[model samples]
Target chain A: MSTSPVTARLDRGVPRFGGFKLAIVRLEIRRQLRNRRTVFFTVAFPVFFFLIFGLNNAYASDPIGRGNESAFIMISMALYGTVLATSNGGATVSVERLSGWSRQLRITPLQPSAYIAIKMATSLVLGLVAILSVYIVAAFTHKPSMPLGLWFATGAAIWIGSLLFTAFGLFIGYLLPSENVMQLIGFALMLFSFGGGLFIPLSQFSHPLRVLATYTPLYGLNQLVHYPLVQGSFNWSWLSNLVSWLIIFTVGATWRFKRDTARV
Target chain B: MAERDVVPRTPPALELKGVRKDFGDVHAVRGIDLRIEPGEIVAFLGPNGAGKTTTIDMMLGLSVPSAGTVSVYGRTPLDAVRLGLVSAVMQSGGLLKDLTVAETVEYTAHLFTGARPVDEVMERAGISLIADRLVAKCSGGEQQRLRFAMALLPDPDLLLLDEPTQGMDVEGRRAFWKAIRHDAQAGRTIVFATHYLDEADAYADRVVLIREGEIVADGSAAEVKALASGRAVRATLFGADQATLRALPGVDHVEVHANSILLHCADSDAVARYLLTQTNAKDIEITARALEDAFVALTGSHARDESVQSNADEVLR
Candidate 1:
């Protein structure tokens, strides 16, 4: 066979990654947004939780921290946004892996970094969409006022918080058999929302569980984002906590993924 | 083409050397050694639990090999994507069923620079007509064809197809093979797996039969069939006696009835000579070895006996 055509093709040079990753990101966003289920779970679920909890606290007349319950719920809502991102994103990855879609991608010229980038980007978009929905709801119903700096801080925290926990979620989904992903996601969400005060305030929990929440990613996000939203100050300890957990999840997840899928 | 005009290419299109995959203690692929040149169609044939999928998985770098190495274009299969080489139509459906056929194919094509145009690939795969429809809305056969379109959109030099026609109707299968043959003739290397012996016999330049984690036979259709080393003779002889037919030399087995006889022999000429000597012989015909028969024989007498036993049991029940 002649090599001329192949040589010509090869000589065209390698593709740039910028457009490829963007395309993957676009595709991922399209797939999730187009699905009514995904939109409901990732975008609408957090809003529903916010309204339910906010309405209940509104009747207290003097909600926790002097009618500052709106600020507190805003932070909790961001944490719930992280949970939404991790659960939905991890589920997507798990389904793709189980159905051999990831295997199919390995054969294409789609770089692994590009693929992972799109997934992380997808998680960020989910987090962003969820947080934005809460922002809209809080403005109309809760009537919470915040400086632009705090809003930026909240958004940044949500993005990083989603990245950290979504990595953890991905690690669990990738390492565990596909059949167990949904069960694990449900369990993890329960732990975060009820035990770590993602929907309710941590003060409502008993002492030991509240202490345990201090070490969880959800607690770190709540503390980090809540400080700026409620007290109008950035907590350095919260930053340390969030970054530490991000390092742990990223390193641990990357290592586990490599060990599980590495080629001999 | 002058030799001087061609650049020296050091690596084969794909190679699997001593590759093995183990899922817990069960060895899926024991030790596979395969080399596909620049442009060749290699068919992998095996029964269930015969490591064909595992081997293809290793070659595509989906599952890590328990031992040895797999390389494509001198790079490991893990890194083949970086080299913009090799593509596959996996046994599992990988397309997002919610997307249109064109969307899936375009998404796949966008993964590589210099990929074939989406329309061209769809045309080549005979799926251009269904380009606008959602993948899930397509018929099973059309979905399979669209999968081929996605796999081929990159104009990958090496294509791996696992049971490409598993659900296709006759016409779909024929159309699929037509596209594959055109690709083969255009110098695209392919490794296809199928249970259909005729597909392998008709399309593949070489067929490799794998069994129990090892390659049992590898050759052209006729060459593999010849491994059985026997000829079949069936005759409806009016005056031949069963006992007399059994007495013929070199005949391994003989079944006789009132008007016909079936003889199994390793040598056709010897059987012909014996039949000619029979004065009562009225009708005789010799048949060439068939791939199906060769496959059954190569798999061993136990398998054949089990098949026979099952048929008999079915009839009796």
Candidate 2:
């Protein structure tokens, strides 16, 4: 009957991005982290890949078949983290869209930019975490790098590589059905990790596979990261290759999302 | 209805003009012209799949209308969203699955400049005790309340709800109705779709009935009921022939089902006397049609025929 309480509450006002959209992101992250299966597949899957590809062969004897093998394995490990994080971000977005959350948010005052920004931020943070988690184990226990510059370059390479993967992931998010998101992420991870010099270096493959690997985004990232970290040199060809894939994927993702949300 | 006395010439808080939506080949909402003035609660009444949701969706700008326009508070619904002048409680309850009740309300409290505080809205929504618990873990009733709280947070002039109490128990439903009435009395415009006729009767200042994507009836509860435009005298007859009952005076229609005969007539008193004199039936009951009977009569017999199986569960459970 009295208006004092409602009026008093109104006087204090809403927090900045603290309610709807921000809350949605926090809730999404918490839910994802709580799901042990998702956590393992996303956060811990890269670690598993690192163990199988980076440590077993490169850290063992027999020269790992070539001096460049460890560099290839590190690239594969970093690629594994970036791909997993970016794909998960897309999958999460698609699931929410199918589950009616997107429509619910559409009715609210939340802007489309805020919606896209949240997903991008979540993916970047997840990518950084995955990259750091894998690199820490690699640097100290095995394949130790002595120089600070290589570490910095490795971080930059991972960031650039992740940007491409995240863009590709966004494209996949709009293309795939919500029910098939997990399967798509898994399929892409395996395809790139094996043929793109993540598990086995390009030099170890046949002439055809080696040539095919150079055209893949994963291969471009491998070359970009490998040149600076292992050979201590930058390659313009590798940077161009990565940027070309990045441009293609970014354009595709932006176009797809705009079409999906348009009023007409 | 009493609140209608307060605001004299207020423009409609919500309006839908010739709105239409087609999902692929199926026409969902077809040419709906609706208007609700300030301080009025209008209940949208319809059976399932009658385009009630699609209509509400267009009104809230969740789905763009295929034809015509939807406006809220004299502006487009999309603009209303930007001004925080419209809020909604969707059928799914729209609560973030992982956040606790407190977090959901607290977060929504941040979306507007004049939103109610987290604690105050929680108490008002009667979810203060479950504030720290995750919304997904709450009971259906609690989740519904939490959604209403989220809608309330913005303190908007127009509130839209879809099946707002679909899953609540009787007591919870009663409490929810009380809150809704309180808000309506406070001069907020509301438009809600509900399956319960009593909800429309008890809380709504106006009721609109939609059937197969068309507006079949629209008016105040009694005014809409008046669309049936007839009265009936139901008599308890012993050893009477159904054939003779059909021939009674002032009777327009006669339906024979199981043990009783429904005599649809213009004058209840005339029919009662005629039934007593002709059929020798005692205990004749003469009564005006309730909203349900009026709704059935106006919408025709096909309205609740398919719902008979679920009617028991819908009424008692």
Candidate 3:
């Protein structure tokens, strides 16, 4: 019942990115890259879409603000690739949980928060790589034209946003059955992209649908990333929607992660 | 009562006080109070749903006990784990199939702040030869060794293994235990759960036999066996009278078959001594009951006793 001796033997307090935290992140990154099918799909899927649309001469010449419609299309494709890579990275925990690796981890010194941080870092690294792959492909084609500043901003926005959504991916991973999690996440990705007006402009949608699109999880992200390219009116609502979803995803993920480790 | 109440200066390696777990209306662990000192190897012998795993879960901090406390070196289970004082090799399914054996060890090692050298632990677990093989491609025994390698990373003060030798062939099992024996010699605290009583008898210094969420007996291997039932003394003795044998000290039952007699008795030594001096008994064999026999006698129904024929053996020849 005495507290002093027990606390004395304790290894002090946990530090953020202390000890083997960075090492774990590096390992996760390696694991993510080793998943060849996911890597192929994540880069190839968006790159394939960009090739079909961004390379078209008609779309190339069509300018809106600082760039042509093709530039906008490239940004969208880059965002898709980034999200695909990161979400896949996060959702891989479903397999880890099902395989009892998470349970295995429970016996180790790795704190769950440190573990979540490691996972996000690894996913975001892939997200960064995915953005560059599409951008690199777009650059070689010399078809998409945008301001240099917009290019960096949009890519950063997309990459950072993907970090937030890893929480959502992790939440889904813990909540859903591991067997069909990847497929369900894939379907969810498609639904979110379309609903958030990533594939098509919200202006192209019917009146009610455009309003509904504004409320979707990806809509705020889509708008935030494309804001520099379009130079449209900045809506405060967009930032709020994004922040709200971040809060939701973070809360849901940590809750689910804790529940499994603290079973009845 | 657990030894924790003795108020020793140095806390015991593991202390459980009336620890119980409940899954809704079902009580998985009714109550358990156990204390294990450092450097002792203990085995939890139990049936399928006898709450061994549940107790282990509570000890690993994988689940909270519905009541009471479980501490390692006086700290909480989670705290003990987070301090890298404890590690486990579970029964199965902790390996990533896609990862090569080395990668699996390296990845697991990265989770611990002060993990021992990956190569060293791999060699210790006798898994260095197959380091490049993917876990999915490895045989069942190989994968289990890989898990052992991972568990060894932190050089934990206490090691808990749940059915560590389950699914292993006899040769593989012996090899695995050889690795464990090397660790046991280093004065590490080890607690393992297993239905394989031979494993318990051979490896554990002390056995805590559990059944239906209760500890039926907690003692040394021989003491637990003695606690369950008496040993049997069999020999060839012509003209042995059943009534006279029953009258002998420590002899409970006497059965004569032609020129042979088998005495079921509490004290095999006393019965054997009397048979040698008084009767014309030869080929004298005092067979102590196997832990498997004691396990069956302690847990579950008598029906399953016949199924463990392979476990029977003669002792004290």
Candidate 4:
């Protein structure tokens, strides 16, 4: 019961992110890919939606910015896809947590910070696949047009933006019961998609509804990602909204995780 | 004496001082004190709901103690875990059904700083043959072995196994113990919980019996067996004399029922030998004291309720 040895060990600080953490993230991604059903639905559904909604002659003709209406819709669909995929990716933790796998991990030397990093990294990979699949389909169908740099930015923005929902997914996984978490995550993401003006344009909504959309979790990320295609003025409030929600979600997930492990 | 000042001696592998755990109204563990040295195979022998799992959980830092302290080596249980000095094979449900056995081991290896090679642990755990199979496709026994393989990845100093051979077949159980015994010979500490008396008696260097949230007995297997020492030798000897049966060495009591006689003694083997050789005894039956008797001996009595006794039934089985 001496404190000296502990202090000595503490002097040799353990790295939070290293080969071990990356290895877990890599393995997690591989495991997610092996679930063919989830892969097929998350990757294919968004592309399928983009084709159905954005491939019309009218959408291709109406110019919104440097691209056309089809380009704007394509970006929207990509954001929607990545949100679903990333949330689903993080939501799978609910099952893992319940299955005693988390309990198994509890006894190991893996630090809690490394675990969160692994989850976020793996979920971002899933989000990348989703958004890329949508973009590929859109390009193949000649549904959207933008500068080459904007296309890169659009994909990067949506992929990075998906981290918010990934943290939300992890939060929900630790908070909600595993059985209904997936269905619940899917439904909640759909509402966020609509409220954030991904499915319907915020410009068309009444001023009151538009103002309310600013407070929705997805609204900031949604508008900011569109800037790559729509080419609009930078809105500082958008960044603030996204950053605040991300902190809220990330903190919530960590809190729930600590609480879960304490009593588990 | 001069050398002792220059170098610190190793601490006990595990030390618990008045550890207690409570789940609201349920006192899962109540003030257990135990010290295990390195390389000792100690079995936490108990029936269901006897606080075996609760104590193990606290040892692994999976749950905090309601009171008291658990030290592994020289630090707290959680510190021991963080230092990668301890590992455990949990009772159940710590596997991903989708991952193959090999992937499971490999994935877990990534959590430790200098974990043993995946193939080495898998082969040592006797799970190499089923490495390619998905965990979902494995039998209960195979899954348990997979868990063992994962636990071995860290090459921990103290290994805790909770109901390790619960679902294993005879062959799997044999292989599991073979691996465990080999590790024991290598000077690693091991603590396992098992309801099977033979597992504790045959494998553990020491047996710590828990019942109704308390340590009822703690000693060598033979010493604990001595606590409930009497056995019976019953045989049909055709008009056996009660006076002759009572005169046998180690015989504590003798009961004659017409043509048959029952000898209750500390040594049943000698009594049986006498019945088979010295007398015309047929259909001889020698029975050792049951685990239930050991429980009764340690605790003075057992549960009167049918439900609680059913848990004891599992111990007998």
Model 2 Cα lDDT, one tens digit per residue, A1-264 = 111212111233323552335555665566556657666765687777766656664353233213344444655676677677766775666666666667766766767666776777777767776777777766665554335666667767776578677778777777764757867777877787666677765789889887887777776777666665456546687778788988998898889788777764
Structural similarity to truth (TM-score) of each candidate: 0.77, 0.77, 0.83, 0.81
Query: Model 1 chain B, poorest ten-residue lDDT window?
Result: B291-300
Interface RMSD of each: 4.9, 8.2, 4.1, 4.6
Clashes of each: 0, 3, 0, 0
B1-317, model 1: which lDDT tens digit per residue?
59658876656777788988888889888898988787778889776678888888877877788888888877777556555577788775686766788888877777777778989989988999989998779887788888888877667778889988887777788888898787677788899987666777899888898877898789987766555466778876777776776676657678877788888777777777777774556467887556345466445544565689899999999
Could you give the CAPRI-style class of model 1? acceptable
The superposed Cα distance between candidate 3 and the true structure at residue B6, in angstroms, equals 14
Residue B240's C-alpha lDDT in candidate 2? 60
Stretches of candidate 1 off by over 4 Å are: A1-9, A12-20, A55-68, A179-183, A232-240, B1-35, B63-79, B132-139, B213-217, B226-294, B297-317
lDDT of 3 at A50: 92
Question: lDDT tens string, model 4, B1-317?
Answer: 55545545567889988999989898899899999987788999888788999999989888889888888877788778876788898989989988899989988888777778999988888889989999999988788878888888767788999999987776788888887887678677899998777789899999998877788779999877665577888889897988898988989789888888888788788888888899999999887656446565434422333457788899999
Clashing pairs in 1: none
Better by DockQ, candidate 4 or 2 = 4
Q: Candidate 3: how close is chain B to the reference, as a TM-score? A: 0.75
Task: Estimate, for each residue in B1-317, the C-alpha lDDT of model 3 and write its tens digit.
Answer: 56456554667889999998888898899999999998899999887788999999899888889999999888888878877788898999977887889999998877776678999999999999999988899987888889889988877778999988888877888999999999788788999998776778899999999887888789998887666677888999888889999998877678899998988788888888888898788999988655346566544443454345335533322
lDDT of 4 at B83: 65
Scored by lDDT, model 3 comes in at: 0.83
For candidate 1, the per-residue lDDT at B21 reads: 86
Q: For candidate 4, what is the lDDT?
A: 0.82
List the candidate numbers ranked by TM-score, top first: 3, 4, 2, 1
A1-264 per-residue lDDT for model 3 (tens digits): 544444223454333453446666777787777778788868988999999987787666699678988889899899888888888888888998898887787787776767777778888889988999999999888888888888898889899889877988899988974767877888888988998887877789899988888888998898888889888789999899999999998899889988866655
